[model samples]
Each structure stands twice: as structure tokens, then as C-alpha cells.
Target: MSRTKLHLLVPLAALGALVFASLSYAQATVGTFYQQETFTGIESEFVCQPSPIGVVTNTVTESGHFVITDQGVHIRGTAIQDYRIDFADGTYLLSVSPSHFERTATSSVEVFTEAQQDRGTLYSADGQVIGIVSVFTLTHITWRDSNGNGVPDPGEFTSEVSQFRVTCP
Candidate 1:
């Protein structure tokens, strides 16, 4: 995974990267660090067939912490992202998603896990509730240094779990 892409998935990467850089030289030390921030932005996402493309105004509140120990680096965090999505038809969806994510890394292996759920009501241009929307996603990954070179070569990683579900009407 690209470290640069981390910001796209979650805001935790910015702080995590800084901490990881400093820890590269002090693997023997043990310490814990924490961070919290709120961010807002606009983006685009695919909703459903009726309104496949939607413009999203989002506000995300996140908190994360990381621990650097003799064994490895461990990080975990929680985020709540509130979104207001508008479509060309003047319909909209208001959603709030709460998610949890964690990562653990050692010399030989790395693990990542994430879970998120979103529930919302889709409204028409007249402000009447037209539908209900629910979405869930869960993902887990494990990467091992099979050759013991500490490099993540192909076939050394596995996506143990990856699931996404959406319900709408």
C-alpha cells in the first residue's frame, strides 16, 4: 500500500507517518503517542443506480493513537464521518458513519483491519423521505515476509476478509 494514499483512506496516516519516521532509528524504545483532529472537505462517490454519482460535503472527526514497542508498531483509531450527498436530480442523502481501524506491524508481518457502518435517509427535492440507505464494509489484511527479507514481495500478502454491502430503496 502506498503511504501517500493513506490520507485518502483515513486522516491518521499524516501523524502516523511522522511517528514512523522517527521510530525507524529507535526500535529499542517503547512509547505511545496520540492525536485528534477534525476535517471537512468535498468529494465524489458512487451511490447507487438511481444516482450513481453524487457530490459529497463531508465532515470527519477522528482520533488515533500509536504505540512503538520493542516488538513492533501498533496503531488504532476511530472516526465518525458525516456526509451530505446531493445528486443532479436534487435528491440527497444524509449519512453518518462510524468506523474503527487498526494496524500492527512487526519485522516479519503486518496486519490491518477496518469496519464501518452507515445508515441514512434519502430525501427527494421536496424534502420528503424517499428511501433508506444502509452500507457496511469490513476489511482485513495480513502481509508476511515469507522470504524473511523484510520486503513485501508479491504473494506475501493476503486479504483475509473484504466485504461490502449496500441496501437502498
Candidate 2:
């Protein structure tokens, strides 16, 4: 897949984790709760040729609050991540991102939204800045389960809005 597509998947994976966690409260406990977590690992897919093709150490810290009512669940959260790609030559590229997300799910409808900004810096083996980059994205989606099957069919799912921007020099 293309790098842009791959980048989108990273946030989706994080969203999946939050959704899975909400499953435990399927009973619809009526209250507001908070959650925080930190994840660190090597994400090889984030690396590319000409810059780095090896391991990329990634760290993400996320925090959020969810409200469960008789009708449905609503969640809002924020995440900050840092990525470091190391090459065999000892050079590295560092990327940092801050993002916000919201999700609402009920019997008949669901909504998911996110906004993110990322900054990247290419550093020489000696820690000097060689280049810089910036990117921003906003996305929103809605689904109406007309059949009540809890699945977003082709006609039921709608990508209401999406915007992406890049700034580099």
C-alpha cells in the first residue's frame, strides 16, 4: 500500500483498540469514565527507502473519556505520538503527532471523527537537523444501520468529510 494509506491505518488501529475496550461495557453502564494508555513498539512499515528502511521505534500516549447513556455511548480522546526511524548509517528521522478523536455509537447510528497534525524532522548522524515537514488531516464518517444488523453496508456508510494538507520546505 502507499505511504499515505498506511499512515491512515495507524490511527484506525488505535481506534480499534478503543472500540474493543468499550465492548466490556456493552451493558450500557450510565456514567462517564476516563482511560489513558501508552504504547511503544517497533513499526517497520513506517520506514521507507532513501531515508530509512529499518526499524522505526514508535511511542504513543493516549487519554480519553467516554460517556454511556441509556441510548448509546459517546467518546472523546487525544493522543500524542513520536516516531524514530533508524538507519544502518546511524542517521534517523523523527516524527511527532498530536491528534483528537470522537466516536458515538447507538442502535441506529454511529459516528467517528478525527483530526491530526504531524511534524517530521530529518536528523544527521550527529543530531543536526537536515530537513523538516508538516502535515494535517481531518476526517469524519457516519453510518446508519437501516437493517439493524450493526454493519455499515455500502449504502449505509457515508464519508461525510475529509481533508488533508501538507507543508514542507
User: Judged by lDDT, which candidate is best?
Assistant: 1
TM-score of each: 0.75, 0.70
Give candidate 1's whole-model lDDT: 0.68
lDDT of candidate 2 over 40-127, digit per residue (tens): 4444543333543556666666666666655666777776677777766777778878888888877798898888898888677899
- Supply the global lDDT for candidate 2: 0.65
Error of 2 at 63 (Å): 0.6
| Model 1 CA RMSD to the hidden true structure, in angstroms | 4.6
What candidate 2 gets wrong by more than 4 Å, as runs, is 1-49
Cα lDDT, model 2, residue 31: 36
Best by TM-score: 1
**Residue 106 error, candidate 1, Å:** 1.1
- Give Cα distance to truth, residue 33, candidate 1, Å: 6.9
